[model samples]
Target: MAEFSTNDSTNFSYPRSDYVEIVVVRHGETAWNAISRIQGQLDVELNETGRQQAAAVGDRLSKESKLSVIYSSDLQRASETAQIIASRCGGVEVVKDADLRERHLGDLQGLVYHEMAKTNPNAYKAFVSKNEDMEIPGGGESLVQLFDRSTSALLRIGMKHIGERVVVVTHGGFIRSLYKRACPNGRPAGKVLNTSVSVFHLHVEDKWVLKMWGDVSHLSQTGFLQSGFGGDRTSG
Candidate 1:
């Protein structure tokens, strides 16, 4: 977690207490995700189970207070999830932004990891090794590119909702990207379950801070406590 406050000659007053609480929710499962394929920019709709997941998340969020704004990736899956949440919150408007979309997978768009590994050993190896500079052959984004775009989207959201509680519905990869950025030197091992919530506290002083992460208590009530999708569960 980065320090949220820093003093400078400009004399910007940093909020002493937590001002803005950003809740990040990954969109429900998609067909591509179920098959273990690299989705990237490829558009895929949520399965029926995913719709149920989103509804559950909406039900949970509807009970919370101080929900000011709802933002989501323009991708159908994310937008649909945001819409479900908004519908539960008395028809709150959902703001869509393309910047929040998942990292462009380029050439790896629809390929499964196992297939890619067997066909493109070097590329698969580089990805598994977390090589920031290695680009997937034919297409696919490098790790650095994913980080840049993900962080840019987060910063934009942070600025837009400076002192409010904003809900962001995005992809698992997008959330994972932020985690990697926040814990650069640490081993990257965190899963973003469908409808899981990650909270971050942003201060204007210096850098944004991660307050809480991967809270899936809402799903526990439904007897679904596992991270990510359990198996080849498809969405509508």
Candidate 2:
């Protein structure tokens, strides 16, 4: 195992003050993650390194946040990551929620970027271009739908547990959507890292503030962070 240091730093301008904090974590890697395949709602399990990353995130956060409850996507990979983190959090309750799952790609599930392009060039192009309203050919939700659904769920969570700290384990696409929603004026945030922690606070004014994004120190410390996968087309 690679030795990791506790350095959680970022370049966001979100203020740190008295408010309800929510730690948003993108689930650790899976086989599809390495290959840049669209998992969508496929329920793929995490790989060995993913499990290690989950443990690392759990270890890192146990001392960092005053965790109250854990909300996780019902998908296997995300649920597994939440379980690991909860185990490290001294038995924090893990609640499964399908709303936190990856955007359903409909028929695009399990396909890589190249494959998707060949099959549905227009939809693939629109998705790769980050067309917020582009819909997949076979019953897929657009990026707008994804952001609306996931953020709404998170907003409810924030409202229900004011002044409390919680952890949400979910997928990359949904993570990106929520971040985009929180920082509407921000530029594209590139990739949503596996096992990375993004923090948001529910302000007294009831607005969502992005405190941090893609803090991958745990994965870096544990040597689980890697690169070189092709870009995602459908972004599921």
Candidate 3:
């Protein structure tokens, strides 16, 4: 059970190199996001504003550093964001990884946030309770499941691209999970805004150094900076 603990890093391994710098970017806003609806595993596309946000972030990254490759969730929102970023980064290759997907909310998918209590009380309760092992009713996964899947996938990618900087286009839920892993003391970190960029450096023996968290400066000048959609909590 400790293996699933957010505080435990013993379950995962890292590369032998000095470090791998990972620039984690949350996918831009979506239609569902505008309505506070739970997208979960649904393949929602980015809205017009989202596309703009992606381009803005891509431009920022292209100028900041050279990316070795882009790893993205197979979902359209993330993949499309990655594609847009690739084009800006001189056509860097984009690799889709299913493990990078948002946590599957099962029955909660597509339900508006405020209406969750009336629509699916039990599942909604489990979600807000933040119980690590309380899997949502229907087919949703537990916090532990997401933690294991995302961390493992990230480790694998870090190993493959040691010493190189890479961009990960993934969901907010996945980003939050890694935040907990990196900040075991649970210090309050601000919201993970759409297209926000966070930086993590992975070193040997499963060590991770969080260089930055939830940066949306790229969106500020572009007028895309805004609040996050629902599911900003540990669950999605």
Candidate 4:
């Protein structure tokens, strides 16, 4: 895994405090996530396990820090997760933004990986190769498109918050894109576990320093491991 370091400067002025913190939380597990389906742009709700994950996330955040604002993807899963966090953090209003939605999977929207590999070998290969230039067979987004839009949305949010501590609930792909930009030399070091929390401190110094990534200490008691699409759900 790649090593990461934190910024130690206190000379920057954030909108609210000495440091501006942005916490990124991935939404909990969903039926699609459990069933290995391509859930991109699908408005799926959290299952019972998902709700429990959200509750655990909420409890963890409530005990750890105070948040100024909570934002989330407009999708039901992300929105619901944000709501849980907001409720735990003093009933703060939750803001939903479409820009935070997962990358559109196009023709691959509902197919599982094994199915896609058998039915659309070319598309499967391109996807696995992480080709930024490859487009989805039907109408899926290229990696470049997802990166551009997601980063733009994040910049807009960062500008608004400036120095405030905010929480953003989004999908694994969205968070991965952000991490790639923040650490462009190589792939992000860790997996984005379900309901995992990562912290980034955006500074006026024109740098985004990662404080933590994929922290799942809170889920230890739950005995659940991170699960993703493309395989049977199981502990990691």
Candidate 5:
């Protein structure tokens, strides 16, 4: 009768910490991303532009701050981005964490937003609305499930590296979920661009602060970053 705790958002909490700066970077674009197809747990590789984005992000991080560690989703896109960043950082270790992965979207894995809307309007509505309880028809998770998954893993990392900077290479959906959770009173969460950087700080009393969200200045100057890969409602 009970749901998996890590897959439910309302019950998760960050452990107390002195201070920790987390730079959450969504993974680079994939072929699925160009067309706005859902990627769930699929291990897709980064497209050429995505590879460039990853390298840009890595270069930005190496110049912006000193990272103590990098925690990345083991999914290919994210893992490859982390590897590129590690190489750019000149040997920063990237720890693979399945917990850092995107929400497992189940049967909705590869459907485009418009296709889902045309085929299953209600399902498309729920997925787009950020419904906390609307699990995808086949086996996908709710938005809250992703919030719980990401926050739990982030808290564990916070407890271990208080007052340190860490990079999180993960998917867009996961970043969007975490952003909603972190900035409860702020703007409505929207698309998390590929390789966009979001910054969060965990305080000593277990409070979380959103320093920045979807900072894509790096992508803007690069010229390779694609414009409008897909429509507004993203499910990656």
Candidate 6:
């Protein structure tokens, strides 16, 4: 196993505070999310319900502490959500980062949830097995790779904005991968809902603590609180 670290005292120092506050959020719903279709890295726009959810969350976050900035995945779903939130939160600058994109499903991308089992049983089985090293077929990355890449990006962001509160708009799989690494003994209780909020505290020594997980309280009245089908397991 390779060791990972974000502690780079040579380049920067945490002068303001010891940790950074990160509000990690899953992107809003999409047309493919409605039907449990795998989106992976393919660009997919938010559905109507998704936009509403985004707005609701945006309104909720706007009322909280002032945000320094909003970091988002380059994917449309996440970037769109970030834009909505930015508008609501006094137009905080939104920075897009490709490293925050969802885990690549490779050959499994674009397939319906149930059809994957029949279409590619081996790859499907490997995915469901939750093996960290098992890479998806046809150019996809492994769970370990997803965790390393996404978490590294997050750590970099944290290091850059120490003592600041920032938002990260990304995908469900990315959130789940982060939960696994950030909370080694703790297990995620349920699906990572669309536009859900999860909070984390990142320390200067590369430590991470999850403050909240999968909170959809902002969308209580939206009636679209249901998790996208198959969630982090089958879709990105």
Could you tell me every candidate's TM-score relative to the true structure? 0.82, 0.85, 0.89, 0.86, 0.84, 0.89
Q: Write the per-residue lDDT of candidate 4 for residues 1-236, one digit (tens) a residue.
A: 22245543223344564346788898988877877677888789988788888888888888655667888999999999899878877897799999999887766677875587787776666566545877776777778887888778876787678768788999877887777767778553556777988877766655767777777777776645445541111112
Q: For residues 93-135, what per-residue lDDT tens digits would candidate 3 score against the true structure?
A: 9999999999988788989877988999999887877568888
lDDT per residue for candidate 1 within 1-236, as digits (tens), equals 46322222112233335445677898887766666666667788888767878888888888765577899999898999999989988898899999888766555567775586686676566555545777665666677777788888887777766766778999877887776655556554366787887776666663566655776677765433244621111111
Kindly report which residue pairs in candidate 5 clash with one another: 17-204, 19-163
Better of 2 and 6 by lDDT: 6
In angstroms, how far off is 130's CA in candidate 2?
A: 5.7
Q: Write the per-residue lDDT of candidate 2 for residues 1-236, one digit (tens) a residue.
A: 11112234332223344456789998888888788777788878999989999999999888775688999999999999999999998999999998888887767777785587797776666566657787776777888888889889888887777767889998777887776777777777677778888887766575767777878877765564454121234333
Give the Å shift of residue 50 in candidate 1: 0.6
lDDT by residue (5-29, candidate 5, tens digit) is: 1121112233324768788988888
TM-score result, candidate 4: 0.86
Task: Tell me the lDDT of model 6 at 106.
Answer: 76
Root mean square deviation (Cα) for candidate 6 = 5.7
Runs in model 1 with CA error above 4 Å? 1-18, 120-126, 185-187, 221-236
Cα-based lDDT for every prediction: 0.70, 0.76, 0.80, 0.73, 0.74, 0.81
What candidate 3 gets wrong by more than 4 Å, as runs, is 1-17, 230-236
Q: Where in model 5 is the C-alpha error above 4 Å?
A: 1-17, 120-122, 125-131, 224-236
